[model samples]
Target: MAASTKNVSVGTVETRGIEPVPDSERHGHAGQMFWTWFAANISILGLPLGATLVAFRGLNIWQAALVAIVGSFGSFALVGALSLAGKKGGAPALTLSRAVFGQRGNAGPTLVTWLSRVGWETITTTTAAYALLALLGVAFDVRQNSFLTVLCLLVFIACTLLISGLGHATIMWINKWATVLFGVLNLIVMGFLVATVDWSKVLEAPAGPSSGVIAGIGFIAAGTGIGWANAGADYARYLPRTIPGRRLVTASAFGAGIPLVLLISLGSLLTAGDPSLATSSDPVSAINAMLPSWMAIPYLIAAFGGLLMSNHLSTYSAGLTMITLGLRVPRAWAVVIDIVLMFLGGIYFMLIADDFYGPFSTFLTLLAVPISAWIGVIAVDMLRGRDYDPDALMDTSRTSRYWYTGGFRLPAVLAWVAAIVSGLLFTTAGTGADDVWFSGPLADTWPGVNGLGWAVSIGVGAAVYAVFGGRGPITTPASSPALEESVR
Candidate 1:
């Protein structure tokens, strides 16, 4: 068991694929969650997000800072609150979908989480590739090429993939050490940026165009805030039962929230000071320009480490998501599939993706709607009660309790679909600044109405589900003992 005050060494007796983190094995303070989720999010990818807010969204540095603070805090707070469920039921977040969606019904949310996390892994990989490419270009004078860039991609992703294939305990340990090192490096780098920046420009920079501020709000508040929602419980499943739910939530929120606000603000600060940095072709190199030569390489390395933290965590959760899809495979093997998919996607983006930032940003924004609604449903379920059967989560038979009308929970699915449709119709997201426009009828008239479609999606879904009695579904039991041993 974990010591009450600190994490104790559980040493190498890792559980099998998708098994509940048994009480004997559960040993860690809730505070460890702070490092887990926090470390997962502290990356240079956030820099571009901040830049988009100031340079593209028309927010001043101070306004961007305010948005980052509020958005990140609320987002991470949701992440942390969800962590309580992990310890309550020793299963991954995706696995827990069985409670909301039936055993067969769970496939819907599982697919969404799986696809989104895979997308996130792709981003993490692309960001790392960018960093390594920049580092190689500067160090060995090797500029962009499909072969050399892919080589860096494979090498860097491979290292993190190996760790990902190892699964949760290993992931948490890596995040702990990584957060300490990268956290310090990022702070020092920010200090440098702060010392060099001219605050006069930061304060004077005007907003981008019409609906810019709202778009920025949507990007940071919803887009960046809830990216980790599906995976929050993945890291928290191992926390000891002794830890209070309040601590779990607090540790998780602060762990992820603080660095996000700080780093995102620094990006805003940089872009506000020099508008040119926003348009720079190479993001890592752009930031590297501000640092001293001695510290530049180390910062890149730290940024790469941050990428691994987010990438492998996504990989790990993607594996759980696959298992949640009722796939009969070892969790490590699921991770292998995730790696292969990520590697393939990474190759495509590096080779053929013409507009990288535009597509990536859009890709990130696309999932926020579904994820927000899904989290809303989950948070509602969590608030109702702590009761859950960890073993039943993998139950896939017709008799499983989660099996509603033809293996789907009608209300939850309908709510989710309705919310997603509304979001898609109303959301003002597109390829570039000039082309970006809201599609909904409401937005058509207002013109300046761009952001917060996610709220409508999630709110409507949650409200519908509640009114329709999502919790009223009848329960049943599985008949196959062997099936219980295998993943759903």
Candidate 2:
């Protein structure tokens, strides 16, 4: 058993603020935490629904499955590493960042956390709007236009407020119900398609192999893992200290990684027949093609409910990030703000933001580099046995080890910058001599470079910091209100 609360206090001075809850109250048995994390991590569906439409383009079922597997690993490995590291260190996200960035320097990672929530919210809202319209087409005939999109945006805004206001407990409650509905709907769609589509056609390989199979896998991994990579600590924090780190890793990996590969691969198979599925990118359309028109009612209801469940995640996560950053205001207020902003972002993307998805895809790719850096640095810190207290991450007190030379570690920052630039280069440029000579070498060799950016960013940061900045031994803050926190 872990130490009692009386012994765990920061000092003998026990002024009663919301002093961190004790280990017993905070860290319950692993089973409860496992289910909670599982519920949160299951939201990976939203990503593939919007993202895989672009990635699996023109690929057969086998090819798409292979690609999704690769992608699922990206998320799996990163989260597995983080969860294990955190368990050993006994701290969570912001506190972990303090080890590398210094107590004062933790703001950098926090900013990234905020941006991710905003970006995710925008993407979720925009994509959900698109699907909502498609489902509506099954019942009331309406063309895709600014007016129709506005209506969808209104609905998203309203639901976002509800979910965010409810906080983590309510969101998890909704997720349990939503998961049931999603599983049923997906089964029906996949079952119908399996029965309807000529298996022979889906089994056939593409006339030519994908030029960027590895890249496709990396893309899938990044998308699948993105949620957990940033927020692993959010759920890990709730885990019983008695649970071994290895067990947590296994639970998180199976709960998140395995299912995503299956779901995304199914989506790829779902779209294998229709070359123009992107233009007609509605799940309802996907089912309609599989079954009779009337059958779509049940499927649509299930899908719409699932979409709401997924939307609850973006809103909830966004509120958590905002509150952790210094919104001492009511949780309800934070959610209201997020919903309003998400609504505006939705309208902006549909009405003003042309190429909403193209850039969004690139943005997601680019983010992998920096977020990967944060993960790498923390992993290195833990492995090396440096200070690892989560509560002390931002403490400016003299005993704080996180305040390194000048309160900022140059090595980690440099490594992060390099990773970000590398991701950008690949996202913007294509690989090849022609791309190099005509458009430039960076452009030519970049686009084809699948998971290279993630590998490079994560690897380079870890290597550089390990070799050069390894000398610093510092105590991380146990808890800092200013440091960013992730949602599980």
Candidate 3:
């Protein structure tokens, strides 16, 4: 990447490193986060999330709705708390994570975060590609074949990469309009479903046991919070430190939480009437099917915009995660690398992820575990008031305190590994509740214990890290000459 991309001040300060947002440079409001997260998360993505609870988890509409509302709170709490780190630390979330994970130790969790972004981007890419194919069928009467599918998939990637290639300010602008365009249009579709779907069936849908309900809520929470867990601070890092923590928290929590509740409610409603909700070709198309002929293309365009909006954020964060994981490249170059990696990874998933793909809900639930654990540990670190010096995290040299013992923090690493392993072994990483990928004794004893492992992982990881890791007294901010200079 050229030096030209940095310090332009078009959309941002635009420098690509973990320098602190000096008090003078901090100037944005917390309220902006409302649209930032709301627009980014509220989308067609929730369709499968809601449908999985109703169709696969055996939850009735009310039960699923209850879970959706409740679970999103927990998810966004994690999101908001981590997001608060940005205003306080003025560093990327993964950068702040170096405090807990140490320099090299953070790589473990960073890779997990990177995988989360790639998995999400790939899935959304596939979603948009399918919608493009459907639009072709609806408008141009084009044939659907393997070649067209691949071609459309490539087209979606090209567009996402091209725009994301322009960088952060552009992504923010795109997300702003994308949200406005999609929000009104999708709300109309939701209203149509609300007025049309038969309530009796939704009410009479069979409710499963407590275990399944727990899993359903866990799945939704993970889906709601996973993508943003490691990226919250990335956007907030540029915000003015004058913003109150409460404002930031409320803005992010509800910003993301509200849309999730709405969309998940819509998903549950759709599953109640549409028996094929889980098996639908594409969720937005399923919504368009409910609309009149004139509305299909317009609605499709709106929903596809959601994917573009999401991919922009994900790709941007993937770049930061790469940098956090020691990719010694400019932020712009890292983003380019992130795009290529996600593109190749999308193709790889299209080829083989389905061997294990039972429900999209399952895949998302598994992705959420390590992420939750990561945030949990970070939160505990914050509560303990240990040093989270931004400059230390950015420091490549050994002088930084975060570079603990060969750049690895032992207790934190152990805590992360223990939590993730515990989560995976007991949770249903495979299709069924009884289908533990690595069955634990507790899980084997209880067949319905699908996602207890993930919940446990969070508590266990936080507790262990709190005991072992948060021992140091908080240190004063390290003097950084770099922050005084224009990093751009």
C-alpha RMSD in Å of predicted model 3 compared with the true structure:
4.0
Q: Candidate 3, 253: how far from true, in Å?
A: 1.6
Each model's lDDT comes to: 0.73, 0.56, 0.72
Mark the regions of model 1 whose C-alpha exceeds 4 Å error after superposition.
1-15, 206-215, 433-438, 445-448, 470-488
Worst 10 residues of 1 by lDDT: 1-10
Total clashing pairs in model 2: 21
lDDT of 1 by residue, 1-488 (tens): 11112222333423356656666777778778888878877888778778878877778876787778777877787887776667767678877777776776677778988989888888778778888987787677777888888887898778776787766667778888878988887778778778768888876777555356556666776756587888777877777766767777788778877888888888888877776667765677788888887777778888888888778888888887887786677776788788888888888777877666776766776777788778777777666553556556656677666677888887777777877777666666667758663356554533226567777777777787777744532332432332222111
> Residue 230 deviation, candidate 1, in Å?
1.0
C-alpha lDDT (0 to 100) for residue 173 of candidate 3? 64
Write model 3 residue lDDT over 196-305, tens digit each, in one string. 67788877777777777777877777777755777888888777655667777778778878888888887888888886767664565667677778777876776777
Lowest lDDT sum, 10 consecutive residues, model 2, at: 10-19
lDDT of residue 190 for candidate 2: 52
* Model 3: how far residue 347 lies from native, Å: 3.3
Once superposed on the true structure, which residue ranges of model 3 sit more than 4 Å away at CA? 1-13, 206-208, 348-359, 432-438, 445-450, 477-488
